[model samples]
Target: MIRPDDETKPFVGRWNSLIRILLVESSVKHVARAAMDYANLYDGTSCHPSNERLARETGYNERTVRKAWAAMRGMGLAERVSHGVAHRRLSDEYQLVIPESWQSLPVLGPSGAKFTCVHCEKAFNPTGNCKVHPDGRVTFDLIPMVFCPEPRQRKGREEPWCATEWDGQRRASGETPWSQLGQERWKVFHLARGEEW
Candidate 1:
């Protein structure tokens, strides 16, 4: 499982955010979950696992992984930055994108929007860096204590919800929206909530 405070691999926090708030087909979500293991440390976006590897990891067939990738592309959740060379045995490189639309949705445990920096009042991009100065100036330079979306400075008396908690309880209990519960249960929960499956 990915952890938020794994400083050696800072991308875990972004992957956590992706899984927590993802709203897509359950099958695609499963693929995405598996791909999280391969998120690059430089940024959470660069994923380069082969389709066969992803299929094996997700316990799905290669065909399923291909379809899932197509669905992810259509949904703007991921993009193939480089095609693999079959002769050279290179795997396709994909970048996982956090859609701007998703930034506005309410998180599972809090009323406030996801991906917002408490200090600067600006949304944190996928890089998990906050470039906004205290006086409201954005800078290209790196600054200390400027990480965002996780393990960063937050307002007094408020914190992000722990996504790992209650995964088997509340999400399985059947809830509305059917969007915050991560993978494989979306369709069931959606149908349970009186929506067409």
Candidate 2:
């Protein structure tokens, strides 16, 4: 008997904020999920999964898998690392590019007036000092932290509803986020949060 788990790889490591952001903006849920699954299997820079394998793992048809792959690549989430093997056709490797620095710009929402986070669900106004891009566009650095469904537990303190504390930490650590910790420790921290390996 071919069990469902047998067809799918264990999801490990922290999901990239960019992927979550894309999922919110994606019109097709299945395709977004497929993209996420592919990202979970990514090894540092790339992952190699045949269409058949992705279809089996994501429970989507091969055509859907191909569409999902193309969509993700088009959205700048996945990049083809290599072409198919010569003569014999083979799966192409893809690199997952997670956006680290996301700009916060003003966008009109259903409420008519609100400053929403360009990357995620969180909302914040673009005040204080802003960075001006080469195209004459301005952006803020008040991006929310990566999504963490569980509330943070602190001694004698009320837990916050969402994971937004990373912003301060990132600023304190200088321009590069997660630069304070070593790579190994960072992985461990992500694992503790239920992120994939």
Candidate 3:
């Protein structure tokens, strides 16, 4: 379901190597690069020419796209999204999915009680992953999301998330990069652990 404008419009006439693939390359990396060029932007979300869509658009063997996509995923150039069981259409191909800053997570201070997430200012009580996408998709906030509803203070003194400072902030010691916190880890940190380190 990658829209034509998805890549073409954003990068705008810069197909570069991919255009070459669209013309005369079939090497996994090259064709995959072509497919990736379809994404054109790395907004921390998966975007691209779905192998199926690419097969339709470029007439390249799905396997070529699949291999290149696999390499891209290995190279950290793209992300496979969660499409539930329905996402199984391509056992080898991975779709680009974005990791949005919404989900279950708690806000902790240097010490003390944690606060809840109130996205768009709706009073969302404790729930799995803390984020409730109206689309039934769950998301978790990353790094307190700058939307942390409360800041750590003395006992019973959680301040607003908007007031927290993020200077020099980093993934907890020995913690995985934020992007690597996939569904399970993300769920635990934000939903289960309530945004704790």
Candidate 4:
């Protein structure tokens, strides 16, 4: 959570360049921009805002805010510092790490090139052709939408090309993608494969 004192600090000018880069290159533009705005609200290394608060401030739904937070974390722009614990269920704390070192931002992969899945953080190579699923979903050889965490939500959004699966399963259950299993389940899956999240 941001310290009360940090709320009084004015926005720094150094974030201008970082914001510009995010506007032009980030696939999740609104979320990234909103994150910057939230960061600017305080003078500390972290900020804590509920999804409802973020939605109200950014004009995005809570689901979109959640996705944005996930995207930011996957892109190494922000990190979870502490989980919220309360009867009313407060929001988690997150540290915006990008402004401190924007010079080292990860580069987006070129067209048709192998890249990491921004959501699953796995490598994928696209075949350049999309396969239309029966449900009107589209996927590529390198990264199938079935293996992605938020295929429906990411339908028309610009995203990095990459492939991911449930680690050991070649095909995910149609009704329930492995990503919905939550972080603890994924960690167990990775551990079974001798890997770590």
Candidate 5:
């Protein structure tokens, strides 16, 4: 299992805030409990806990857990065991996944939101840098972020969540975003205007 450590600490703090709070709300707490049950599947050996059993453990009504499970499925957080009969749930294979919207800038620079990567597993600092062409046109490089489901940093405390390196291929020569990232594994994050961001 991917134990939540310093590498995953930072991003989880920033990105998980809303989801954490939301997951604990009204119907959502059931969803959270179910997610935890699903996560238990990969704990040590494997868990195929039934949704029914999960409800019993979490104090949620069976029907309510079912509904919450469906909602979690839509959010890309949980999946059914087979066609759908079992209470056993499936978890994301990669375990960490960041959405594009979270890694993006709505309007180029400052107007954009900042996020940490689930894959790269780090939070970009000061300001999240542009992952695109520094030539002015905003490039959409894959920014490092988090899934925020594991043990992570608390709000008042933060750790590293920047992309030091990526697992995939390097970009073609002269490709700004890829090369810029290559300039240093620890990248100098900048904005669309190429200033400190």
Candidate 6:
């Protein structure tokens, strides 16, 4: 999780990855931006804003805002911490979360040890055409897409997902942007790879 006022490198990196890489829908991105503004001015962990306020801030209709909220929740970016009681006239509160899968990813692009392949022990680039093998041989036929041997799950954290070549192929083929395949499909993809979602 990141606070809206956080200025640290790690926080900023995670924020950049979320807003720039993970979020694909424009409306969802707009709502997320508005939520961040509210989060900075409001409480640190959560923000309470009515749908109308979000709509006004994003220049979107209430329905669009609602859909964006749902999409954000599905993306594991934000979740409602508290629901408003209509009779009491309270507003919903939401807390932004950094998905475990994104924690080890590079802020700008694939970098560091998180992208290293378990098979070749080589660091793979998410958007590249080739990679240097362990024998110091450059392979032009391979795209250097990589994944963890298995899902990395801590005691309480959500399962951390590493990218595979299929993800790169989808991006290369222009089928779907990574992380925008919707929640169910993303889960199925991981589960198919023997990761328990």
Candidate closest to the true structure, highest TM-score: 6
Clashing pairs in 4: 124-163
For residues 84-158, could you state the per-residue lDDT of candidate 1 as single tens digits? 997999988888765554432212222213343323444443221213244433222111112243454467865
Report the lDDT tens digits of candidate 2 across residue range 52-113.
Answer: 77777767788767666665564444678897783586878877644332211111222323
TM-score of each: 0.46, 0.37, 0.28, 0.41, 0.33, 0.47
Model 6: ten consecutive residues of lowest lDDT: 104-113
Error of 2 at 178 (Å): 40
Across residues 45-117, which tens digit of lDDT does each residue of candidate 5 receive? Answer: 1324555676787788877765555544444334344443334454322232223332222221333344344
C-alpha lDDT score of every prediction, in listed order = 0.52, 0.44, 0.39, 0.46, 0.37, 0.54
| Cα distance off (Å), candidate 3, residue 128 | 46
Give candidate 5's error at residue 141 in angstroms.
32
RMSD of 2: 15.3
In terms of lDDT, which candidate is strongest?
Answer: 6
Per-residue CA lDDT of model 4 for 86-163, tens digit only, reads 676877887765434333232222121343443465554322222334443332232231123333436668553223
lDDT (tens digit, per residue) of candidate 3 on 67-145: 5555444433346664324355533334433212111212222222343442323233332122334443323455443
TM-score for candidate 5: 0.33
Model 2 residue 32 distance off true place after TM-score fit, in angstroms: 5.9
Question: What total of clashing residue pairs does each candidate reach?
Answer: 0, 6, 19, 1, 15, 0
What tens-digit string does per-residue lDDT give for candidate 6 at 56-140?
Answer: 8899999988777776666556768899886887778988766665522212232222344433344443332222344433222
